[model samples]
Target: MTRDKHDFKKVVPFAFLIFTIAEFIPVLAYFFPSSLPRNVLTYSQKRKLIEKRDSIRIQIHTHINNSAKTNKGSDNAPLISQRDFINSTNARLVSKKYASSFDLSKTADFKTAKLMCKFFGLSSIGTFSMLKSRLAAHATFLRTDDSLLFKDLDSTVAGLSTVQLIEACDSRGIPTTNFSFPHLKNSLVGWVQFSNSFSTIEPGFYLWSRIFLLSKIPTTN
Candidate 1:
């Protein structure tokens, strides 16, 4: 009886090891979606997204460059208003980990905050209380983003996978719509390659003197 019990314990551990490995394969991931990280893509998923993006690079480059050139007529700036473009981007920009840090609140005062908002071009001529203006300002900063940093197209841009694209744009406030995967990929490629004196900020919020305050700093009345 003692010998039989010892053998059974060894067999149980070996079986569990096999079950754990099987549960993580691509096929099993679909069955147990909750087990996987919902946002980050697995290796196989990323590979597929890359293949799709590469297949349609030309369409992307042409469309973006042409669009930017046509938009930038006389003044070395894009015809699309900064506020308009940023507002149109997805609102779900901040990652959950970093979201708690966004201090868009009424605790901020009136005059100083509004001045900061006006400087960022986040409003009409004049706005209401500092609270509303600051919210608008924070949103605008989060939304303002450029495609592939408007770099030379031949260089290796468009390397991000689908989730990566979404996260990066969400982080930078780049405009992405309900377009198909291929169309979105194409648009990004073109947008990146085109050179522009766009006169618009790419990575925003870092310079927003109003939106984010260093939490560790002490404040006084």
Candidate 2:
């Protein structure tokens, strides 16, 4: 009986060891696949992304340069030319407010224009005018040179898509006011009103100053 009991005890430990090894095999296989290596972004993929990004930057730079030259000499001198103003203002809003930060020095004009359209809810005339007025106020306060402001403005506008810009403003709870203009769509323009509760300054004036302040900040990556 004693000899039989000893044999059973020895058999039980061996069985347990076998069971443990069997369980371990599947777990190890799951964590380290034998057939395939892990997927990662290749050098080529990284290069492509960089190239695409640079192309956009070049486009924005060209647009601003062209616009600034077009308005070079006029009564508006220091003032942003109407056409340039529209373009730059749109660009600044989109790029600064909506798009991924890129090096401003590298951007071109068309890219900037596209970014503006995307960023400031400028799909329609009404929204466009609203953005225009806001920008004008900013330009006025900074006494910004039309050329310099145009670059920043273009960048801002180019940074966002139209839908994204509208959504952002909506999210902020800014009010939109309506007006009728024969040439404008929806004949409505939106303006963010100032609250006397916060400050005695005129809301429009105050808001304009804020835009100027934002423009001076360095672009972030």
Candidate 1 structure quality by residue, lDDT tens digits, 62-157: 343355457664778753322222221311232122333333443244554443433332322344554454445454434333332444433333
Query: For every model shown, what is its TM-score relative to the native structure?
Result: 0.25, 0.22
User: In model 1, how many backbone clashes occur?
Assistant: 3
Supply the global lDDT for candidate 2: 0.30
Give the C-alpha miss distance for residue 149 in model 1, angstroms. Answer: 3.1
The reply for model 1, stretches above 4 Å from the true place, is 1-148, 172-178, 190-195, 199-221
RMSD of each candidate relative to the true structure? 18.9, 25.3
Error of 1 at 198 (Å): 2.2
Residues 1-221, candidate 2: write the lDDT tens digits: 01112124345544564577756533433442221111122344423433343343345434544564565446656233222212334434433442332322223444333443322222212343444443333323322222232344435434645433332232222211221121111111111111111222332323322222221221211
For all candidates in order, the CA lDDT equals 0.36, 0.30
